[model samples]
Target: MTDFLRRKLIQAAGSAAALGPFAIGSVSAQQKGDIVIAASQPITGIFAFAGTAMNNGLNDFVLWKNANGGVAGRKLRYVSEDSGFKLDQGVAIFKKLMASEKPSFFYGDSTQWAKAVAQDAVAAGTIMTSSTSLASSMADPTGMPQHFVPGPIYGSMHEILMEYIAKTWSKSDKPKIAYVYADTEFGRDGIPAGKARAEKLGLPIVTEIVTKQAGIDVAPEVAKLRRARPDIVIFQGYILAPMPEFVRQMREAGLQSQVMGTAWGLDKPAYDALGAMGESLAGVSPYRYGHETDSTMINAMRDFGAKNRPDMKNISPFYISSWLSGMVFAEVADRCIKANKPLTLPNMKAALESMKEWDSGGIFGTLVDLSKHQAPVGRIYRYEPKTKTMEPASSWLKV
Candidate 1:
């Protein structure tokens, strides 16, 4: 991680710790006067960049809420641990937090971790959970009532991208599609649905390539893609590193296929990494970028950063995603309070599921509905190397 990001993370940790528990020894049973919010984040691993941004956003939101007298007159006590983006570590952190903090709300690091602890979370009966993951499996209301997402599931996002590809394809041309993903739960989560959606749209999926999340050499995968001669290739389960390398290698190999990515692959960092090669890149995003000053939520967050974190210059999409997730939690807590309901897991679940047309202050372009526990809305964006930013390629599509 960069020195700037490291310092920002340290500052965020200190600020959150000041308002709540920082260690297991400092935490006791949940107090009636405090609302504990615990999380497991990938603060020091393959996803450190994203995890640090997410942690910063979550801490900023918690601190902002506390400064504003908190929700329902109850101060939110934020606590978190690093999971290193490892499922075992994530599960262990969840168990430790539950036992030590007895938190009412939990933020998970990955979909695998959320799935691992879903039954336990339900059995616990009082704790509600959200995650960085937008896996379709986590949206099950009957089985995972206490778990929710801030945006559309990976499958839904994949479908939206597929629909875009289909709509844009010429009637006389049959576009060949390729799927490249990492060998992780996140990398593979959307494949089945993406394949089905492609079949339904009559887009022929020519190949599927599996690569490491942080692969250094993608020549082999690029070779496969070159041979397949896909019209478009979609990447999944990567944040910054490997995808750019893949794109660079593909370009060097004279591959003409247009590259698209899912949420994880759609960010400024990726564009910055791709450099001039990113001009042809396009992807889908659940929320607007931090540089998108037109958004009320982005403007508000920028103002917050100027006042509180003057040293930080750029806010990435990962940060906005985490901040929006915090907003969702706060909104649900406020709703439960207004309804005169106890702030328990079940009440929180009800409040989340009941959300409809909830304005996110332009965090999401349209009103949010959580009837399915996922925001079924997103937009396509193409990266512009000349401007070094992602420009909207399509209006928000509701899937």
Candidate 2:
């Protein structure tokens, strides 16, 4: 990593009161408090693009909240360490925080880490967690009571994309569609359900291509897409690579398919990297972006970024997800405290379940209903490369 990036990460691990946890990586936090919100963040590795932003976003929110008199007058402490996006390291960090920090709420790195640690978390019943992964399985409040997905499940994101496509079909024939995804769990987990939704909408899925998440060779994939000539090509589980190359090659092959993606593959940076290729790129997002004034949370985020992180022009969607996680944590904690309950597993779990039609300060344009443990909502956005902004393409979808 560049020296500047390294420094920023160390700062993200900044401590709150006393020296932070040392066994994990450098730990940065916000405020000094008893209600600990610890995290096993993916600060380095293939996912750093999103993970680092997550660290900053959560830490920043904690700082912001502490400035606003904290929950129930109890201070909130935010502690976190970089797990380098590794499952083993993330699990270790989780264990360390649960043991040493004795936190009331936690943020984990991925769907894998959340599933791996759920049994332990539920057994402890003293803490609750939110993760970057939006796996549908984690949304089951009955099965994974201790873990909650921060946004829409992987399948619901796909289903929302299908809804957008179905509504926008101006062609004489039903739009022929192609689904391209990586071979990872995040990639393939949602395809079956998404395909089912598309079938229900009577949209013809012409092809499904599975490939590596990031690699140099996409010619073979593009060759298949070329042959299919579907009107829509939707991507999932990819961060940056392959999508740009695939789009470039498809255009070179003289095809005119509309390219779209789920949340992961369509971050602002991905589009910024794509430059002109992203001009035609439209994707679904669970949270509102920073370019608009419609959302109270989005506006606050924009002002906060300008003042605190001036170098970062566009706040990341992953960061918004992290901030949303912090919101949920604080909300649960506040509810528990107000109810004169301890921050135990059952109490906090009950507090979380009680959330219905909660206003997220406009983070979500619509009132959030997390009764199912995942927010199955999204809005379609088209990239405006000239302005480096994500402009809305469709209304908010609560699927």
Against the true structure, what is every candidate's RMSD?
9.0, 9.0
- Candidate 1 C-alpha lDDT tens digits along 293-367: 778878988999999999878888778888888888888878866775555555677788889888888877888
Each candidate's TM vs. the true structure? Answer: 0.87, 0.89
Q: Over 4 Å off in model 2, which ranges? A: 1-33
Q: Any residue pairs clashing in model 2, and if so which? A: 13-27, 13-28, 14-28, 14-29, 125-345
Q: Residue 331 error for model 2, in Å?
A: 0.4
- What TM-score should be assigned to candidate 2? 0.89
Q: lDDT per residue, candidate 2, 1-399, as tens digits?
A: 235434432332232112322222222222224689999888889778788989999998888888889898977889999999899999999999888888888998888898888766766656789988887787987667777888888888889988888889964688899999889888887888889999999999999999986655888888998899999898887887778878888889988898888887778657876766544678888888867898888788888888899998777888899999999999998996686555656667678889988889887788878888888888999887667777899888978
User: Candidate 2 at 266: error in angstroms?
Assistant: 1.2
Span of 10 residues, lowest total lDDT, candidate 2: 22-31
RMSD of 1: 9.0
Could you tell me the lDDT of residue 73 within candidate 2?
95
